[model samples]
Target chain A: MSLSESTSRRRKKRANGVEFTAKEFKRQWILIAIAAVYVIYGIIFYYLPLAGWIMAFQNYKYKTGITGSKFVGLAKFQFLFSDAKFLQVIRNTFCMGALNLIFSTVMAIVFAILLNEIKNIWGKKIVQTISYLPHFLSWIVVCGLVHDALSSTGIINELLVKFGIIDSPFQFFASKPWFWPLVVLTNLWKETGWNAIIYLAAITSIDPALYESASIDGAGRFQKMWYVTLPSIRPTIMILLLMNIGNVLNAGFELQYILGNGVIQSVSRTIDIYVLDWAINGRNMDFSLGTAAGIFKTLVALILIVAGNTIAKKTGDERLF
Target chain B: MSINTMKPKKKKMATEDLIFTIFNTTIMVLFTIVTLYPILNTLAISFNEGSDAVRGGIHLLPRVFSLKSYKTVIKTEGIITGAKITVLRTVIGTLSSLIANALLSFILSRKRFLFKSGLSLFWIITMYANGGLIPTMVLFRSLNLIGTFWVYVIPGMVSAFNVMVMRTYMAGIPDSLEESAQLEGAGYMTVFLKIISPLCKPVYATIALFVAVYHWNSWFDAMLYNRTNTKYTTLQYELQKLLASVTAQGQGGGGGAASQTDATVATVIPITIRSAATILTMAPIIALYPFLQRYFVTGLTIGGVKE
Candidate 1:
């Protein structure tokens, strides 16, 4: 029991709470019944749905559920900002989450620095195992392979009408300005080889003697990948751009709910398909205006992840938690 | 440091590293043929000939071969009950979320677990808040867990980012191997079933290849709690209801083989039975993707470098 005397007797039995003493309930009642079955399955599935977020200030019903509904405080966030399709579903969830966070983080850092300049280790592990085979398929099989690769006789309109670049064929899911660059090129073909395996494991853990001291100071190989592997993976690209600016409002919900239709439904809806079309697929179920637009998208994704982890801890970087 | 000044700086860095290794091996062989040309053109339009794969130019291979869309996706009784409820929820939701996230990451990597930081801030406020989607579908329709099958094995077991990636890989082992198995009178479930579950077999093979690829790429919790439960339907929600009935018959007959030369779109569900149900939902993740691709490339760099 000597890991610092079992962490100083668990900080004096967590400051003597609930006073357990039968030899500390016979060595912590089977570790308090295995952390009380995940804190009672995190209080019946994550804190009883944050107590059904008070059915977004009531007016909810479903046979009088949230303790006989009808409170209606902020009038379902004032009819979700006087709804113009909830401001075109918050400008299609901030322009497809900022063009899928700037072209899937610049095509997964330019395909992990051009597959880390290939020098054939089995052709960079068979092109990084066939580039994460569309990152484990299903957004309903990547919208059935993005509607058969943008059909109009697919293969991107049979190579843009065989390089004539469009004499015909370019419906691209009935183009509402090609629905946000076809949802950022279908999220860079299902996450550019699973987001370039953490910048190719931070460019293969850098220090090959800083690319042999930037090629003995002459610096070739793309200037030692721009002066030694992009300044040693600039704090892993500012902690993955502070977790992609807290998922810029999670710009996806099964690829705009499986490539939204009615000719790209107003640039494909998003705020989780406007809170599953006003609570569970419309016709006015309106669970308090879909729990007030899912509590304004979980309070603006917990204030953009605590304002991008307080601007990555005041720009020191590497901050998520 | 001078073989005649490193022989003309190694022949002017071998002609600029042979023109940057032939332009980085031709952009990694044209980005691995544009990431394997849409799963090999959906396996050559799922072995073509569903009305000759809707008249378009099928690619990779099959121009006229025919399995008749894998015998209409194996004589679809909703694709064989959504492939027996997506192989019984990807083998019981990846062995019950890999033994409930390695028994709550071995009780939050017990250095001395007295409610380890208030149970790690109660599962890290469920990884940045939830209760979305209408108060989690009105608390899963008041905990009936809506059209059950334990709503796909109980609301995705436990996860605070897979219990902070198995409590940061069981807090990097060696607390003198759980204090020499608590001085040999081993308890905490017999030193987590014999010394921290056999030193967490490489984080239980990286959280069982991330909970068996999130229970075989979940189909939006069987399209939101078994939408009209065809007995807990799955196979990616029957390939999203055959890709919303071939995108509403290619937007009311503009194309998809000119809406099957119209005898009411020749009883829809074509494009070679949605390319043999998208190659039988990604042929068991490309046949267990090269033995779970080195445990999900060290489980996405240990769940993308968390603390």
Candidate 2:
């Protein structure tokens, strides 16, 4: 039979309340085949890894493999709690993550509001374009730029010295006290513009009639922005904040890894970096211990996401799930 | 308009709005300067004479201009190999990922596809719950993907986020278009390739640019899997290695015996070369930005607000 004849026959069968005909299966076979590929890919790459998390409980060794490794139960978890450095790493991760979330979110919102208020389209476009360019550059490049700018004799110090703000050049990267602030500032500089794009989009979707009504009520520019614009985009803000809460432990490994030095090691080593150090670069290469840390981070993130989603759902805001 | 004309009250509002505009413009200008200055400063240092750059007064322009740093960086063997590998992977990776993601998204977007929900759920679950770093690395190692170029191309062949965005975009396309093509007895592949694919150029370009940028900028995978294999090292990874060396040398109290060979070049700063390398690493992405700007912005707004 021709393809159309078979399709028509299948349609007739379907109309007659019959199901699972060979012709029906043949018609949808292409889609099924495509989906099968994705399903296999997901199983191998995604689901297999979840199973591999079993290594966290075992004394995993490359020679013996995960299945052959002796089961050590909660020994690795015990080690994590006993290790002071690991505890410090966790603290560093949370502190840096919280600071990053607060500063980046606030700056993005403020930048979006300011950009929205600009009447000159060309100026707004130019500023927005320039601001977001840094986002395209990798952390390696951003760290390189930050390093150069904060170097002892770099432009920052030159200006400070010339203005007599400081008597001499200060080593910004070397100081432990300056590490967290620098991380926060770098996060702000790299992400504020890109993050603001969502807020800007949200602002554009706000009803223009609301602004007009506010104008008729003798509302000034700031007053209209405060009453009409901010409230309108509050849902977007809440949703983004909730999502960011899930990532609070993922303070990131790259920027800290690149910019960190022995001087600021205490402040710079995040949980991901801690995992890399133990799993890949440790003296004995403790795979099981590293896997336990990895499992911990993932579980916390999952819990946070679930909690955030539940809260958002309850409050009738936006839920990621 | 009549009320404003009768009261002549528009002047106060105009003045207040003007002040607001002035404040906004000033803040934006300052921000632009801050963002642009670092890049321009690095550019200036790259061009300046190494000795002059070390003396530290170069701001916006080169003091004693020379291409020595650029020449040195271009001549490095690792950089050349790294660039070749980076470009090769980016082209291969972007093309494969775009095709894979496009196919998956197209399948999902079709209303006739029976298991769309099941397939989407399979991918979306991975987005929220991952095996994390160690297990994923172990899986890659076990597959023998650690030392091969395919490692980069294969693992990222299909991203759930890109699939979601493309699927949403494809769903927005009217079903009548696909039905018309199907009425002419076109198969699914023909309907997708000849009809729907052409119509999705904007979203395709958007996702393609994103995938390309990701492949270009990726270094973490190289640092992990390709650590032992220098042949597969990417440009970004090479730059990172160079950065580590520079930092190490700085901490070790400058070039120990290396500066003795060229006494005249002793004053030449290592940072000048590093800055030039940094510029070389970023130059391609910066160059591609202007052309890809419109598509990316459209993609962001669509993916951001709609999703």
Candidate 3:
């Protein structure tokens, strides 16, 4: 009789799928609720503010809220597309990104392979420590160091003249062609050591037997490296390559911001800097275009990430899913 | 096979290894000179008397060393205020980020968290699609966080890669530990904090270092949000402005120690003061790295191991 009566009063799953009788469901919901607050932390601070993308379509003003800002639809993009300066910014961004990717990866991989070959552990540790220090430096210090070395009377120029490489001191930063290489090399110097950290991990994971077999087959160090080491770390290389492709649009902001000058601004301006200049300095207060540029960067980055991941998947079993 | 792993070779003289060591040392010495010289030059300049910095040909050492530039730079009330803000922001920001990352990653690590896939998709979508900076700035202003230090820390608290790293590390942590804790009547929070968190100590340290350093180094947020409010400028921003002002003044051929206040009066500036300001700005991080380097590699690997 009690069971029959209870059957009439039985709990059912809620429409939102919280089973009334299930403690696991209740606990899950409770945890989800607590986590929802943090999800908002990501949303309110990191994600939702992206709604500011609408401003790219509007003529934004400090006086007007985003809702009140005048919508200009495609005008900002049209202007940007037509602007020669913006075009230059695009070219510079891509060129720098491509060069940086090539040089940083190659050098880092080579450095990692070389470091892995070090028979003495202490020497390797010292080299790693020395290399990683530069990455900790803020660009402000880097820029100053850069300025010191590149100045007309700086050590670089002095050395160049003394070595009979040049007749007189050449202004490194002042020259356009030199600026790009300088930026690239400066980045390489700061990042190669730190960047090689992952490759070192990949190399360490390589089975010792493979190297032994290569030696048994009479392979020298170079042959063992090419046949054994590189293949073992191939997946790491692929994944890192794919991940970096997503960052191609980011190019860099700090280096350009610091090294940029009137003479070299044309080739040095990145999309981030361009958007920044317009958003902060220009009178148009036309935030929509700036927002559009941001959106463009995000979109391009996303496409590259997905595309790279797909290509990686097709080529190798591993990809950033 | 065990001996085969060693190629069963004779102990050949390591002459080549010695040569390679010398080569490596030479490479590293050049690297050290390249890396440390400019930084050291800046340090020397920061220490140099403000008067001699403008002649500007300093290399490994300062020709006329003095601590006047440091005194002048450090004496400014703004630097103290900025440093306070930066340290506060770094600490609080790191705490918030660690919390957020841990929570997000924990949820994602659990297979039974029904919305794990949905939430990852949601977060990843946000990574690819965003309104952009101005809109975000507008939102900050509307929220009245524009001039607040929150502007510096909030937007960057939880990054995609950091979250992913945290998730991967959490996933790799043996799940049986959690099951055992549960069997002993430990709740999820207890399991997470008392047990799992400790297991991820190396990663915790690395993330702390990373987020802390990031907050310490960032000037963009301050540049954007506190541009006019020098009262809330971060140390890095203040340092940058000092450099910019010096460079602008140095344009004049007038030989001299330039006064910071009279930034416009002189076209020429001391090289040492600029270098000194740079050194002053970066000293904290330089000092911090050596102590943390022992943990760095292990921490870096845990946090950065690619999926």
Using DockQ as the measure, the top candidate is 2
Best by lDDT: 2
DockQ of each: 0.20, 0.41, 0.36
How many angstroms is the interface RMSD of candidate 2? 8.5
- Could you give candidate 2's per-residue lDDT for residues B4-27 as a string of tens digits? 574656787788778887888899
Can you write out model 3's per-residue Cα lDDT over A147-248, one digit (the tens) per residue?
777777677888899899999888776567887898889888888999999999899989999988887887876788899999899888887887788888
Each candidate's B-chain TM-score, in sequence, is: 0.39, 0.89, 0.83
Best-to-worst ranking by lDDT = 2, 1, 3
Pairs that clash in candidate 2: none
Worst 10 residues of 2 chain B by lDDT: B255-264
Off by over 4 Å in 2: A1-21, B1-15, B249-269
Question: Alpha carbon lDDT of residue A217, candidate 3?
Answer: 88
Q: How many clashing residue pairs appear in each of the predictions shown?
A: 0, 0, 15
Interface RMSD of 1: 13.7
Sort by DockQ, best first. Answer: 2, 3, 1
